[model samples]
Target: MQIFARITSPATQSLTTYRPTPSTISFTVSTRPVPRTLPARLLFYLSILVRIILGILALALLWAKWRITFPIEGDISKGVRAELTTWVLGSSAGQAATRISTRLQWRLLIPGALGVLWGVCRRGYTEESLLVLSGLGIQTSTSSPTYLSTATTRFIPTTSIQDIFIHEAFKGFEVRFYLAIVVQGEEDVVVVFPNLLPRRRILEEVWRGARACLHELQPKSKF
Candidate 1:
């Protein structure tokens, strides 16, 4: 990882307000990044299934209404036009369907977001060392930032860091997702977060913190 850009003093000052402790840095990340273990992978896919089911149900409701409002005969009579208009844009059922779709989307966001937040709070970072990691997903304004679980904190000496790589690629929709942090002897830690900020900027900040520790260990970095 490289700190391509230096953070401005004013911007740094503003961010310091959130760092309650000295020499501490924090960021939100996902709790589970597409599990590698069999059991975890199964659970991850099961969650996807639940979301798919919800989406299918929403589409099915809309399709049912569409079929009822406009039969295959393709009638264009004045009464038929009125009924179609009511069912699609003006009827109570139409309104109900719209609300249901919105509600289901919100339901998916809740668990998906909360699970990551809970993980971060419990494992975001360890206090004893320079590296800190918590929950699973990127942090949210609604989450409690400092409520970290000490047990999950592991201190990897700055010298042990061989290379820091942040891999970014688009999953879809102009939103490039997935960030992976590959450590020397451990499994790669990959995270999936919303692309609110550019990925490079986030990586820069993370590298800045990690570098701070590494620089103290070795004034001249090897890589």
Candidate 2:
């Protein structure tokens, strides 16, 4: 990964306390991007009985969809089919129910519901990243655990950036260092890597690199 953005200046490096102030910080901070793929270790919250009920309902739906003659039909089996068949009447009603069940069955709902449940139970990030483009704006992104959801993002144009600073704040009982951006026309500063607020040294690295790339520095970027 590109950790720093310093220009080679023979005189600049040798001279102490000179124009560049040691370095400029440009921040395209990072945390690994979360993969949308289902994790190898996943937890399911449904009780065994509830899951069995769902499975029976699924089997029943398959029976209806393909017109299988069932050996047994119970609350666990006919649960969904019986409910939908309630809407209309006749021998053809079963056919209608079968048609509707094809669309509403567990084939689609299980995966979707499981995805939502996974997101709720596993409250953590998969990926978080920041990107800085010279003379352009910067972009920050956060990846969600579930592929069903989109990544959250924001972009701040270069012209709207007032300053980038490192701030110390108390999270719980301890102080933490975080990189923040001063955006034009915004009262509250934008925080970088808010979730993964790394250590001071890391922030310092990003802070210097971000500034170096975005602004002209001491010794003034000589040719």
Candidate 3:
């Protein structure tokens, strides 16, 4: 009976022996996110190209102005005559000079006129005031007949005098004169006197005062 029991136990132990099992997990692959680039690089390059083209055009214009030379021939007097004839006939030199002068005049006159207009318009007459500065001297309002009479008597006695130079600021002069006259209503007529002074010390003082006033009113610096 003991031998039979031992045989049965050995058979049970053999049935319970460990066996290896295959893993069920699969391997995972990680990928990184790709960075995107901006498209503004093309626009930047185009702007640079445009600026270079403009610079080249400007240089060409300057060269044309300087390189247009008239060749002299024959006697000195004859050569001068020939040169004058060529210039009158729109020679290269004449053309160059014309182009340069026209461009220069346009550049100078347009901005200058605009600046003058801006200054005049900016100083629109609202009330009577007096301004004294380094380059500009006493700018008095000429809105009233009494003020106009006083200014005329103090500066120009004759109405025929179109303009007068007044020494103002330290070493600057202002050209002062009547600009226009306006009739607002019955018994309400006003004369406008505009003063044109150098945009140096005299204008700077006024600008500073204006800036201060603006800051005080706005409580912030715009410039």
Best by lDDT: 2
Candidate 1 yields a Cα-based lDDT of 0.45
lDDT of each: 0.45, 0.60, 0.35
lDDT of 3 by residue, 193-212 (tens): 23322223433343444223
Q: TM-score of every model?
A: 0.29, 0.48, 0.19
The regions of model 2 sitting more than 4 angstroms off are: 1-124, 216-223
List the RMSD of every prediction in angstroms: 18.4, 15.1, 38.2
In model 1, which runs have C-alpha deviations exceeding 4 angstroms? 1-23, 28-159, 173-179, 187-199, 219-223
lDDT, candidate 3, at 177: 28
Q: Give stretches of model 3 more than 4 Å off.
A: 1-38, 68-102, 105-223
Q: Write the per-residue lDDT of candidate 2 for residues 46-106, one digit (tens) a residue.
A: 3334555555545445546544334336665467665554433234745554666657656
User: lDDT at 99 for candidate 3?
Assistant: 71
Per-residue lDDT, model 3, residue 146, is 23
lDDT of 1 by residue, 1-223 (tens): 2344543311211121134444444544332244679999999779767655555545545554554445555445457665765557456766766555444544564464455445434422212212332211122222223464222334444444455455656555654533344456777553423223234665566556544533543345578
In model 2, state the lDDT of residue 37.
Answer: 44
